[model samples]
Target: MLIVITSEEFVEDEINIIKRLLKEGLTTLHVRKPFFSSEEMKRWLFNFHAEEHQQMMLHQHHFLAEDFQLKGIHLKEEHRKSIKGKEQDFLEKIKSQGWVLSTSFHELQEVENQTLFDYAFLSPVFTSISKHNYEGKKFSVQQNKRPVIALGGIKTENIEKAYQLGYQGVAVLGCVWHQENVITSFKNIKKEYKRVYQ
Candidate 1:
C-alpha cells in the first residue's frame, strides 16, 4: 500500500490534489492536521466525495473516525502513550467495528509490541526532504512482525529501497505536498512502487 499524508498546513487546491491522488491509486490518506479543530476537520473532509472518507486515516479527534466512517485511526506518540493501559479495550472495540489501527515509532526497538495493530510507521528511512536535519535512520526494517510502512523522506528514488528493507508499504508527505506538481509526483511515486514490488 502507498499511503499519502496531508501537509500539516492546508494548501490551496488541496482537495483537487487529493482527488487526483485517489484516482492514481492512493490506498490511504493520513489526515494529520494538528491545528484543525474537529469542526474544521469535518468541514475539510466534507469537501471530498463522501466515499473518500473510507480512505481517510485520522490522527486526532478519533471520535470522528466512527462519525465519518473513516478507514481507521492513527495514534501519535503522545496519544499512544496516553492510552497505554486501555490499549486492549480500545483495539478490541475498533477491531470489532472493523477499523484499522496504526501508530508511529521513532525507535525500531519500540516496534516489538504485544498488541497487534494493522500497521505502524517507522520514519526517516532516508534524509528528510521536508524536515531539515532530520537525517535518515537507515535502519533495516526486516524484524517487524507487524506491517510497518516506511515514512520520512520517501520519494520515487528511495521507495524501492524501502521495500527492499522489508517495509510492507511507504508513506509520502513532503515528496507529494511540497512538490511543484503534486499529481505528477504522486503518479511517479506510485509507478516506482509497482515497479519495485509488482
Candidate 2:
C-alpha cells in the first residue's frame, strides 16, 4: 500500500523514472497533474505499456478511466464538495467498473465518517516538504473506519511513525521527486514501509 504521487509540475525524465519505479515494484501511482489537458495526459500515458495502466490512478479527466482502465479515480477535496448531490451515483459508477475509489481528507474525522471511498488520504502528518509554510498535524488515525494513507512529507525516516499512528499506508511527493536520485529515494521509502508494515 505504498503510493507515489506525481509532482504537480513536470520533472525531467519523469516518464522514464516512473517506468523504473513501476519496474521497481511501486504499488500505485496517483497522476495528479491538475493543469494537464486531456490530450496532454493521453499523450503522456501513451508512453506506458497497457499493463502499467492498472497501477495508475487519475486525479482529473476521470472520463479517461474508461479509455485507459486505470486502477482508481481520486476526488480532490474541492471536487468532492462540488459533486455533493451526485456523489453516490458517481462513485457507484466507478465501483461498478471495478475501479478503486479514493479521495483526500484534511481531517481524521472526515476520513472516519467517509463510507464511499475505498481509501482516503490524510495529509501533513509532517510539515510538507513540497509546499512552503504548510504545517503538519501529525494526525493519528487510531479510530478510523477504513484505510487512511498518510500524505505530505513522508519518507524513509518517518514511515514507522506513520504506521504506528495507524495509517494504512503512506503517499509520497517531495520526498521522492525532490531528490537528486528519485529511484533510490523511492526504493528506500518503500523498503522502510515494508519493514514497518510487512
Kindly give the stretch of ten consecutive residues in candidate 2 with the minimal lDDT sum.
87-96
lDDT of 2 by residue, 1-198 (tens): 899999989799999999999999996999998899999999988888878999999999988877998898998888888889997888778878999989998887788899889899998898999999988999999888799999988888899999989999999999999999999999899889889999
User: How large an RMSD does model 1 have?
Assistant: 1.2
| Model 1 lDDT tens row, 74-149 | 9888987788888888778898778998898888887766355788988788888889999998778787677888
Best by lDDT: 2
lDDT of 1 at 152: 89
Q: Pairing residues by index, what is the TM-score of model 1? A: 0.96
| TM-score of each prediction | 0.96, 0.97
User: How many residue pairs collide in each prediction?
Assistant: 0, 0
What C-alpha root-mean-square deviation, in Å, does candidate 2 show against the real structure?
Answer: 1.0
What lDDT does the true structure give each of the candidates?
A: 0.87, 0.91
